[model samples]
Target: MGRTSDAKEKILSAAQSLIELRGYSALGVAEICKAAGVPKGSFYYFFESKEALALAVIDEHWAGQKQDWTGILNSDAQPLDRLRQLFEVTEAGQRAGQQSCGTVSGCLFGNLTLEMSNQTEAIRTRLQEIFDAQVEMVDSVITEALARDEVAVTDTREAARSVVAQLEGQVLFAKLYNNTHRLSPLWANCLALLGARVPQEALAGS
Candidate 1:
């Protein structure tokens, strides 16, 4: 039982790394198994297909990300400040990934959305749900900021979607350019999208 479970985890870890470096379409089950140090049969035992494995990887990645986002977005800090921290955390995370891997890995969900969303209905639907959840989280933070008059946005939900889109787009740029610095504009851009009432310079010092 222990070894069986360990094999499954090894496969997931290996698949995520390979997918980040290359992508889903370029990989094969045998190659994934080889990287995982597991037998090809073990891949079948755990996941019925490569797509199934991909979904598992997406779920696992999002589970960790959701926790990090909840910590920052749901923090006791001022609402807009929480949003700023979220951007800061994103930049830091991308920088860390570049240092570790010599390139930006970008957001997994975003990457898969571009690479696989149209290729499979199951993958498309799952990606949509994940992104929708992200928008909802951002919407909650924006709504709080709206209540405090920290931002001038009348449509918090739409503003939140734009903010999330901006973040994802910046991350895509970071990955495409293989430079983490490309993510530096996220906070400023997010504030602009929200019609933040605070001066950008003042917010920076706060």
Candidate 2:
């Protein structure tokens, strides 16, 4: 891409990493520019405001993740297995985050919501949309499982909501405790919610 486009991406990448590591309100334009190796003056030329940059960051992150989610969740594998695989991916991602930031930063969407929702309506609205889309993906998986008789029929959408919410809680707690291995409860809860036979280790908090 051209210099302008490349610079914009650098700014977004820098801001995304910093904000995920710290928080939106804690990191400023200068910090992002420095990390991005771009001039501070160029930030405003690319993004109208910090909120604009944050919104773009969310979009960029979600766009990159969509393909991975589609490949895993929309595959021909058993729906419940697909769901389980999603968690496996999440576990690896959490570990990677810890390695990169020296702590679990948790889901960007969840982190941004807690940090910015009460402070910025524009950002809150953007986050709500992303969150709803994620829940819809989960809902679709549960619905598929029901259609295939892979699991007992229940409110698939509600089940999706519960799974997503509980996983986010597990992520938050894992980060709070500074340990990425605190995802055992999430596995057990998710399997149980889907009517799958929960692993004994997961049941015993292993």
Candidate 3:
């Protein structure tokens, strides 16, 4: 049972990494099996089809992201500072990917949203829920900030969605251009959009 679970875990990790690198439509089961060091028979034993495996991948990705987001969004710092920390985390991840792959790989959820949304109903529905959940998390942070008078956002939900959309759009552009510079101004721009204080250091460095 331990080995069986390990194999499933490896397959999920490999498929997610490959999907981030190559996109969903371009990868196949054989490649996934090879990358995971699992046999085709074992893959089927765990997942009924590629679509099922993709759904698992989405679950895995969101679980990990939510864990991090919980910490960032629930911090005791000022709400805008927590939002700054989230963008810092994103820029760091993209920079690390650029250092490794010579390009920013972008967010997996956004990637799947663009690729498989129209083709797979189950995957598309799951993606929608995940993104909506993410937006709600951000909205909570925004609402709290509004309550405290730490930041000013007229419509909490809309402001949160705009921030998310801007970040995703910046990541897509950076990945498309294979350059992290495309993301340089994004953090500052997002702060401005929310009418949050543009910290001097963030404005100067970013």
Distance (Å) between predicted and true CA of 202, model 3?
7.7
Which runs of model 2 end up more than 4 angstroms from their true locations? 197-206
Model 1, 1-206: lDDT tens digits are 34999999999999999999999999999999999898898899999999999999999999999999999999999988898899899999989888988999999899999999999999999999998998999999999988888888889889989999989988999988998888777787888788898676744223
Model 3 clash number: 0
TM-score per model over all chains = 0.95, 0.91, 0.91
Number of the candidate with higher lDDT, 1 or 3: 1
**Please, what is the whole-model Cα lDDT of each candidate in the order they appear?**
0.90, 0.84, 0.87
Off by over 4 Å in 1: 200-206
> What are the C-alpha RMSDs, in order, of all predicted structures?
2.3, 2.2, 2.5
**Cα lDDT over the full model 1:** 0.90
Ranking by TM-score: 1, 2, 3
lDDT of 2 by residue, 55-111 (tens): 999999888777778888999898888887888888889999899779898889999
Candidate that beats the other on TM-score, 2 or 3, i.e. the better one:
2
- For model 3, what is the error of residue 80's alpha carbon versus the real structure, in angstroms, after optimal superposition? 0.1
